[model samples]
Target: MSAGETVHLTLDEVRALAKAGLAKTGLSPDHVDAVAETMVSGERDGCASHGIYRLLVAASSVKSGVVVPDAVPELSEPSPALVRVDGKGGFAQLPFRLGAPLLAEKARKFGIAAMGLNNVVHFAALWPEVEELTRQGLVALAVTPSHAWVAPAGGTKPVFGTNPIAFGWPRSSGEPFIFDFATSAVARGEIELHRRAGKPVPDDWGYNADGHATTVAEEVLSGAMRTFGGHKGSALAAMVELLGGPLIGDMTSLQSIEADGGRGGSPIGGEFIIAIDPAGFVGDLLAEYMKHAEVMFETITGQGARLPSQRRYEARKKSLVQGVEIPAALMRDIEKLLEES
Candidate 1:
């Protein structure tokens, strides 16, 4: 490719590249495939922060011993409606995969179930797990802790992770309603991407060491990411931290970092996922529920509103035909890793 030229790759190509690179880092075949699909989905859905750009960092984490590429998740049940998984210091996806089906089964039988995942590292978007649950006719909510990079309201230093939360509500047909976001003003990875490309972030996105806001991506990263809505978002982040960490017998972002010798990589924490079966409670009422929900949806969209996952769905549709785009520099970096591997 010429200087500054971008590369477009089919979804299969992206997945193959990611799988090969991740496998070379010593991840087991299943683990490599899981991570590759997650990463490629990010690119296909236009979530650049969590997409192929993350592969290098993931590789680094494996090398740094922060992630056990070949580790397997262990599942256990503490109650009829509670499912738990220990990731054994591996990626979060495997644990979710190990536990989700059990949770779904219990939820179907008991109306609701919770899956607690500990000793895991989450470096990808949270929607995939919850969205998959929705496909099984369940509503789902998932939260995961990350590195402490967001400040509580009125604070200088960061005390919370970007702390993403994802929720999915299954529709009667077609795509489900799914939404995922970081409680921080912006995702931490977006800032890192800006820093990598030598760009500035918005002032509201973060603070410097002195607690003053700044646009310099590197400075923001050096200090703290900001809460999206002042105290409100901070509170949500705190909730996620407690749910994904302490409540799940894992460390909060700060605690994880302190325990891990202050290493900078994807966080070692936990995930909390809740699956609720609407049919168990409503049964035939579900159709009525859908009717009411669709009425509200149609009313909102009539006024030019849109559903939460619409953008992602549109992006996915386009990517199916046009392929995923990789920045020239990033492609070169991945190629170098492939060569090294």
Candidate 2:
């Protein structure tokens, strides 16, 4: 296939590609499974940045020696409504998988609960964690920091990570209402993809080392990224930094990047997740409150306004039946990692 051509792959094929690539890196079977599932879901739902493309990044992390391929997460409960897990320097997926059940249970018992995951190397989006809690019939919010890449609003230096926040709300029927977005103008991965494709970025997405805005992807990669919505986005990014960092007794984005020591692996830090159970608050009037939420959703969609994650859900349905398409060039990159094994 031509470099720019697309290749269609079923979800199973996507899983196999992820698993094979990760397994060759000496990651344990369980970690491989968890990571592969996250990648497959990203591809199935049309998130190319987080999909099979991540295999190359994961493989590089293994080579960096910063990640423990077989590290097992350890869990503890310091309070009735709080759960904590230490990832032991492993990827975040397995830790979240191990702690999610207890988190949901605590939320159901106490009306609300919080989970803190520390020392985990984060790479994927936060949506998977919150979405898992929503499947257990709770409202969930999750946030995490990454390596410092984006600059604070109106600043020239890099301080904040992409600092994504994800939220999930359970509904009586159909898919949960979910949103996951970076506080920055765009995800760092998107810029990296542009660089790989030999393309320049939008004028506002990144700035050079001297704080001058530029369209060159390489400059942004070396310099800093701009936050979305100017100062408003900066404030939200600060909230994410505090919530996912000091509040959890873990490293902030700056600290996380410093700890990396320029190894260029995933960010080592904490993620804070909160889950709320409506039944605990409404008791017998759960249906009444749910009706109110449905009306809100209806009002928004009725006006032809698309809800958050609507396009993703629609893409998911189509991919399930028709499979998904990825760039031929990215396919070759994934194949190369497996070949190197």
Candidate 3:
């Protein structure tokens, strides 16, 4: 198929493609499964940026020897309200898996808890992290820093990562309420996608190395990406950098990129995840409060205001029945990676 053509794939096909490609990249069997599941979920939820396309970036880290293929994630309880995991140079998924249960337990016992995942290569979307906690009837928040590619407000220097934050609130029934977004004007992958498609990005997306506004994606990549909402977004990005980096005893965006040694791979650093139990706060009134929450949601939807995760949930339903479609160019690329490796 040509680069412009598209390939339709079932959820199973997406999983198979992700697993096969990741396996060829020297990620261990378990890690491949963990990461592939993320890709499948991304595709199933219509997040093209986080789907099978993510293999290119993940493989870059593995191929460069930045990610230790066989690293084992080790977990420890740092405090009654905090858990920590050392990823030992592997992907973030396994570390999170190892720590999630402990996080939930601590949250249940202490009302709130935090988990720090360190020395991990972060690639997947944060919603999955928070969504998992919400599934256990807990509110969750997650944040992580990417490489130092974005500039703070009104500044030319690339001092901030395209830091993303996600929050999840459990509902009485069906899907939870969730929102995940990058502080950058657009995700780095979005810019990369524009570059690969030979398309110009929006003027506000980035600036040249000299900091002049430009519509060219490649220049923005080598130069400075803009943050959304100017100062407000910059501040949030800084918060993510701080909370996910120094707060967790890991590298900041600048430090993360420096550690990259010029490898165009995923960031190597930490993630901050918080879980809070509503039961702890409301007690037996949990049911009443949950109904109250539903009223708020209904009021919003009743006025035609959509919840942030509505589109994703809708796509998920459709994909479960109809599957997903991927660009043929990306498909061929993955196929080649699997073949050559």
Candidate 4:
């Protein structure tokens, strides 16, 4: 879609849409606001696949009794530096809101704090959580498991999740240096985007149901997404699934059978967040860290490498200056849904 053809929705308008959608599911204003804020943040950051497009899915899951809006996270303080929260099949944003502050508090006291969350719905974007921790002068690392979308090394079957991992570090320049990415060759969302656009996937990105590599998006959707770097990516995906899926006694990709039955089962995924207080390790280390990071980043740029988070960061700046861009088709769909509501 051409950027010039995009529509700009104000934050208020986005919130209103989310509120109306959530209300249709019998959610209270407070929960609606929470979901809306997360959705708008994703949109503002230019993650369109995880932004407004997923709102319909979320609302539908709630209305279908797949997700419980009133479900409270069961919090457990297993250690001074760790917390485990069972999301009780509620919206993902709830555990994020509850865990972030607690982790920040614990990080302030200890050198680091880690939290494990389970049984939540999809967490749209990882940047917002990292942004929150960065604002608290802490570095945050987050990892989450997903449905089987990627194949293991030398294997044809879809056996692993996209399993994204994200990291955020505070900078002396006031803007956090954040990196968030999927272990797969491309995000599953990107594949979905191509499917929606009726485009083909890159041949290097995924394999067909018969385990042959192809550039057809439909084949990838019906088959398996490739890991980013072959065996290395497959290994990392496995590690992520271990840390972010079953390590905390949560379900894995193979364990998620509810979706097959047309019931909103817990996606049975897990997420882990670790917040670290830089000051605890080295006072004024933020400055030193930025210095090294800058040098490394400049070297990469000189070698024709772009930083991981630079694109989204630049997109966010432009959005703030010139309004966020929403595809005309998406806007039309959103408008139609709004009218229906």
Task: Write the residue-wise lDDT of candidate 1 on 92-128 in tens digits.
Answer: 8888887888999999989999999999987888998
Q: In lDDT terms, how accurate is model 4?
A: 0.77
**Runs of candidate 4 exceeding 4 Å displacement:** 1-5, 196-198, 257-266, 284-290, 298-305, 339-341
Candidate 3 wrongly placed segments (more than 4 Å): 1-4
* CA lDDT for candidate 3: 0.92
Mind giving the per-residue lDDT tens digits that candidate 3 earns over 19-130?
9899888889989988999999899999888899899888887888889988899999878799999999999998998899999999999999999999999888999889
Q: By lDDT, rank the candidates, best first.
A: 3, 2, 1, 4
Residue lDDT tens for model 4, 176-275: 7788888888877688778888888779888899999988898997788888888998998898888887777776765653352546343556788899
Best by lDDT: 3
TM-score of each: 0.94, 0.94, 0.95, 0.88
Candidates 1 and 3 compared: the better one by lDDT is 3
lDDT of each: 0.88, 0.90, 0.92, 0.77
